[model samples]
Target: MGSFLGFSALFYFLLAINMGNLMVSFSQEGLCSAPPILTSADSSDQPRYWKVTNPTLSPAHLQDLPGFTRSVYKRDHALISPESHMFGPLPYWTNTLGAYLITPAMGSHFVMYLAKMQENSKSGIPPRDVERFIFVVHGAVLLTDISGVTHSLNVDSYAYLPPNSTHSLNCDTSSTLIVIEKRYNYLESHIPDLIVSSTDKQPLVVTPGEGYEYRDLLSASLAHDFNIYIMDYKPGQFLNVKEVHYNQHGVLILEGQGIYRLGDSWYPVQAGDAIWMAPFVPQWYAALGTSRTRYLLYKDGNRNPL
Candidate 1:
């Protein structure tokens, strides 16, 4: 009887610890959004949260455990390498959810996250007051809009969600997504309509000077307070100039390799690397290697500089 009671006590103790961790973890959420994993299976810390939505859902380790998990390193706002990203509790989401997150806390006016979702994963149906932009990097995602309209998005597809709109996302296959969110001046702009489109379908514009090629995923007019760009570079091309401007940017390297000059230093960057720049930080990029380099970039647009 004594031995049995001891075993029972141990079981309850561990269960209590796990439950406590779960409550604290769900308070925040996504990846430290894709640093190479530093810890191996044998040496990993015991998972603090377990995926347990229902009997039908398979289990996975919830990696972002509140304070226990965060960006792999202290992020340098002027420039963040691919290795440093914010990891937090992603509550109300399920099934192999992983994202490298960039939030306002990191000193940007906007939030961006690269979400890696498995089949059966979804973004919870909640009406966030902020506007949202989602770019599909791979796989398929179904977006349920504020008006209950459902849109299907495939590779290179994107969606712009207006402020105060209720929506949710469902992925039927393995997928990767970049979700950018921010507050908008509805009073000034009158809330832009939701836009659903594909990047590949947009006309590519060659910029002045060095002829950098890109497609504006959003309009350049006041109707949009921000813009998303998929800029492409050939192996030997470079940015037209060292851009120093009022507009800040969050950039995710989509393909190939390049050297990025941010602030006063240059960092070698490649696919899956995420970089965030604050207003007035000098920045430039030059593609390297034998292939083209592409990146998804976000910049605040059309708003008064005040």
Candidate 2:
């Protein structure tokens, strides 16, 4: 019994030491804190999502760190894990599920947040001042638009709400959602209509390039200043050339792993990671993992030179 107890104690001690080392490694990789307690929203038995409470640092202040640039945010470190409190006032959020604020790391045209909502939670903008999109990453949500039309959105769901449109979002179960808002910079004479669709339902269109396919969620013609696309790249695929564009992009990696080239350096990216590129920055991507790599990308377009 004494020998067994000794071994057990030693085993736990080693485990603790290994956990400490792992945390140190993550910290070195620029995570603001320890590994977060995350719950999969797909699981039926477990809680659908995790809530971040009383963060110590603000989301905007995270940009002040040395590694992040004005035009690129590699991850939502502080907002996802909720170790720091850098979020400013959030007048639009009122729910039991907490919200993690994300300051626009790439550009000033949008306000973004990751929200965890509980069953029966009532939240949303009524007659918004800006155009916005609500994307359901996990679980489901019921969205009601201005005309009292309701739509049920499941995972991979995308909905665009036009400016001055009244909308209400409610979920019957716990869910995770990303809300992005931007003021429309009119490039044409007419206002764009609301677009709603699931990425799974959208047909993949082969692009002119090799090893990639894209699905347009919000195209340039449908929106005033931006286009949203789901891009899929098979394993070992890569861009033909490093390219630069006058338009900027906001990208969120949804699945698999890859190396993203921005400017002169290449950075490793994976699921849940995000990137922001300024106008004319050289960029490229190559799939590195065994599985297919996919991401949701946003590019501002259709506007004259400011």
**TM-scores of the candidates in the order shown:** 0.72, 0.69
Q: Each prediction's Cα RMSD? A: 14.5, 9.3
Worst 10 residues of 2 by lDDT: 48-57
Across 83-201, the per-residue lDDT of candidate 2 in tens digits comes to 33233434655553544344455343565566777777767573345788878777888888889999999878989988888888887787777666777776556688878888878
Candidate 1 TM-score versus the reference: 0.72
User: Residue 239 CA error for candidate 1 (Å)?
Assistant: 1.3
Point to the candidate with the largest TM-score: 1
- Candidate 2 segments whose C-alpha is farther than 4 A from its true place: 1-90, 96-106, 126-128
Clash statistics: count for each candidate: 10, 11
Give candidate 1 misplaced runs (Cα > 4 Å): 1-89, 125-127
lDDT of 1: 0.72
Local error of candidate 1 at 162, Å?
Answer: 0.3
